[model samples]
Target: MEALKDYLPHSVEGKNILITGGTTGIGRATALLLARLGANVMITGLDEQHLKDALKDLYKEAKGEVYDVIADLSTEEGVNATFRTADSHFDKLDILINNAALPAGKVENGSYSEWQRVINTNLLAYTACTAQALERMKGDGHIVNIGSMSADVREETGSIYVATKSGIQGFSEALRKEVNKSGIKVTLIEPGAVDTDMQDQPTQEKKEKVENLEMLTADDIAISVLYCLSQPKRCDVVELKVRPHLQII
Candidate 1:
């Protein structure tokens, strides 16, 4: 049971994977995780320096093929160009991880600009990227959306981030029905507060404060991605939510 808990027939040794927002957080974590599993990983983000650093980290972890495409996922043109660049190299994408996301940054006193930026980057960008991705992927492809607890529970606030995240959940549900016959699976990964920059400065004390709990790590999320990809094509992994035990209501 232990060996088969995450044991599936599919392997990432030669699969072509495209991860958006691959510079930081879960996206970066997935890139390294997939690379280590022998997949040819391609990442996209706006930060050139960060991208370079992530590639280096990927090599250190996997020592294999890792490609980086520079593009802001916030705009239609950027999303389109990213797909074009990736398609030029790989004809089909076995896995597409829409992990690229931005935080809602202090919504209490935030203005409309902040809300719009969050919506554009986190919500619209994901839709645009997925559109271009579907055009290239044919059969048995996998799509994983890095969703949030805010989407399921009360929207975090400001209605900007919350609305966008809610869209991800809705899209995943609709996409599953639409693509069921197409052999493509759409899954939503809703995780609780991570010990990353997304939660602001998540220090050791803060991490320790939550006892009897399992704080979700980037690697943990990446492992979930790997697990889903490892499953047999006939099997489907739908919505999965990870919350630490100490996360009090």
Candidate 2:
């Protein structure tokens, strides 16, 4: 694979971006990259300490302004607060990265509350945030939805997670068509097993498989986000599916 620096472009300079779940993993990685590329960035997360620590790191390397909002996307109030924070931080938004998500075990193993948590964070929040962003965006804007390859592979214990991703795919498609005439572009990124805190609870067999296959890193997916945003306004990258070469599914 080519180095991420090789794909870096200056198209993102001066852009204002908001990323969900930016305290860690793919969202954090993307926020850092966009900051370095001169985009004003605001990230939202539920943890106060994590958000503070992430801001320190972001400010250290960011060429543009960096901000963080503490909000849990699982609730409607939290989702609304995030956009309010973004509006206060940036003059206008150029990109919205819907990367916040929660993983659930099996359908039968999880309770109604657990199912609602995953669904709200993974699927509902994405739509809600996009709607608010659309209202704030002027003529042109980009919406990047971070999905999962599980939507296609559909693992046995990933029913809830896969369902949310499938919904993301459908939502991205319909939203793209609905807003394309207004100069807003929608892109969905589906990534396979990424090495992040999200995988900390994997089973022994799953861990071994990830180690053997050499799973993709959070930065890998972040680079894909840059590529999507770097595209010309006339050309929209509809969907990008990235996976490790050794990954079977």
Candidate 3:
């Protein structure tokens, strides 16, 4: 057992981690797992009730400290407030997970305000959060951006979403090169057909899809995140593309 432990040298225990859009879906799942592993976690969400609820659940399973803040990442002020909460709670940040996002919609059908909200939440917030995280990190940190496979698929339905995700794909690649010299690792996880609130399907239908392997559960993506964090510092899992076995998209 001792020798087998050498396979993964890094550990999340005692590390300080901040996750954006963490009240529901993948972000919540990731926070729960990290908290269980003894990492101090700070989660940001837009809803006050949702934040309270998520914090209650997180505290139940967490070994290290758990905190939550109300944040609307679509605006600049919200992003600043979120990190200020992080600064007050944690002494330093070891990991940053950019997971907050809005649902997809066609660019042509939506109002300008709608498109702006989506862009700011999905793409711009990730970049802004990275900048804030970088300031707090003292070398040897990790940043995980939760992107989507829609970037590559480029389907007809959600052109705006595809744009932001595609931007993330390029942004992650470039950011990795920029941050690597500073000993900070950047990873992009692009998931396909995840059964989360983002999907408008009925609850039962989504459950059936997951059962049939047509869709992935939020927990599945959380496990992938844990895998990336547990690797040795010398190894950087740059990009991870995860899809369900039967998911065509």
Candidate 4:
């Protein structure tokens, strides 16, 4: 923790960062933290109100710049529009965090349309946003992809969600290898059962479901995001899997 606080802004201050699904939950938490730490943050979500709400507390704590883009992010146009919105606000970019995602669907008996919706939102849009962000990156940048434990575990309820997340892990790994020479780092941040909208907070019963460990707050995941970006330029924190201590994966 002292190292993190001391390393502080090796080059982070005034850096422009893009975060998808930043309206609420983990994305929002990460955005606020980066902003407080002196980075210029741009966030995207479908809800303008939620975006405002997310910024409410952050605005109070920080003095850095932050922008919000209202984008559906499930369609090609939405993805493009989000990039455009960020481009309009900032001239250069440094970080791209793919934090937005879609819900899971039952694959076996699910409708084809439902499957397409899930894949299109989770898989296709992530690709589109990454490509567009890369095009706008001024120099070497960071791409932090939020992946899932469900990708490796049994996502009995969310089969499609699991598939895309698994594919995301692969995509990030391949992209990291391809871009390593450029000094651009691509990392997959796989977290399990965070206390966010993507997963409900543990009920009294669910909390009891685990013995000693507590649930993961969005801030916990935010710290992980910071840790990745805080690494020295020559070293990359490629893949970080953060699960509650009691939940062994």
Question: How many residue pairs clash (N, CA or C atoms closer than 3 angstroms) in each of the candidate models, in the order given?
Answer: 0, 0, 0, 0
Global fold similarity of model 4 (TM-score): 0.91
Runs of candidate 4 exceeding 4 Å displacement: 1-6, 9-11, 200-214
For 1-249, candidate 2 gives per-residue lDDT tens digits of: 545553456778888999999998899999999999898999999888888888988999999998888998999999989988888888789999999988777897979998998999999999999999998889889999999998888898878888999999999999999999999999999999887777855666555666687588788899999999987677789999999879766
Indicate the worst ten consecutive residues by lDDT in candidate 3.
1-10
Best-to-worst ranking by TM-score: 3, 2, 4, 1
Give all TM-scores, in the order shown. Answer: 0.90, 0.92, 0.97, 0.91
Candidate 4 per-residue C-alpha lDDT over 173-235 given as tens digits, one digit per residue, 9 for 90 to 100: 899888778768888999887777666544564445434564577888999998898887777
Task: Give lDDT for model 2.
Answer: 0.89
- Superposed by TM-score, candidate 2 places the C-alpha of residue 172 at a distance from the truth, in angstroms, of 0.7
* Pairs clashing within candidate 1: none
The model with the greater lDDT, 2 or 3, is: 3
Better-scoring candidate (TM-score), 3 or 4: 3
Per-residue lDDT over 1-249 for candidate 3, one digit per residue giving the tens place of the 0 to 100 score: 346464432378889999999999999999999999889999999988888889989989999999888889989899999999999998889999999999868877889988999999999999999999999999889999999999899988999999999999999999999999999999999999999999998999999999999999999999999999988778899999999999775
Where is model 1 more than 4 Å wrong at Cα? Answer: 1-10, 105-108, 155-158, 209-214
lDDT of 2 at 222: 93
lDDT of 2 at 204: 65
Which pairs, if any, clash in model 4? none
Cα RMSD (Å) between model 4 and the true structure? 2.5
